[model samples]
Target: MTDIIEAIERVNGVLVDLSLEAFENDWQRQWLVERGVEIISEASRHLPDDLKARNPEIPWQKVAGIGNVLRHNYENIAAAVLWKLAQADLSTLEKACRSELAAEQSRGRR
Candidate 1:
């Protein structure tokens, strides 16, 4: 659906924004990581459990963990961890989102 696609686009846009060097500095990284967490939470909320299960390529738990960290323990959140997530996990998440969208579209057609 268009809604899912829109959500993916929004997530990608924020990911792109966060990937920029300006967002990497200590002054801005936490805010960017928070924003990243927000984007992942919004996008993940749109995905049905069945779809998520079918697509094991996505790290759903980690996606949810961002919100948990930001909400409950943000004061002790680590920059290195956030940076590692940005570098390591975001692309996989983005790809999984696109794949799920495609699968949903195919299911609708059938």
Candidate 2:
């Protein structure tokens, strides 16, 4: 959960400085964001089903599958898709991660 939150924060930090045009034009930023997504996706897979069920609003399966796409189909990923993910999905994912973490902590689960 902390990994997911940290990954989102890292991507958000990069996105603050980039427009879609700049994000597309810069390979480094694209890679950084993609890597962050991979981390988020991988960590999300380890979350218990009940915890994820608490937030059905989040697309948990899609979140887990994203890393597979990044790993296997990375060459075909569009810059706009990545940009949209950063702009849109990231904040929602961050909120879900934080909420789940807090819930776990309150339950006395480390």
What is the lDDT of every predicted structure here? 0.64, 0.91
Tens-place lDDT per residue, model 2, 1-110, is 99999989999999896789988999999999999999999999999988888889899999999999999999999989999998998899899888877877888954
Question: TM-scores of the models, in the given order?
Answer: 0.67, 0.94
> What's the lDDT for candidate 2?
0.91
CA error at residue 78 for candidate 2, angstroms: 0.5
Off by over 4 Å in 2: none
Q: Tell me the TM-score of model 1.
A: 0.67
Error (Å) of candidate 2 at residue 35 is 0.4
| Poorest stretch of ten by lDDT in candidate 2 | 101-110
- Which pairs of residues clash in candidate 1, taking residues 3 or more apart in a chain or in different chains? none
* Per-model C-alpha RMSD: 3.7, 1.7
True-vs-predicted CA distance for residue 69, candidate 2, Å = 0.7
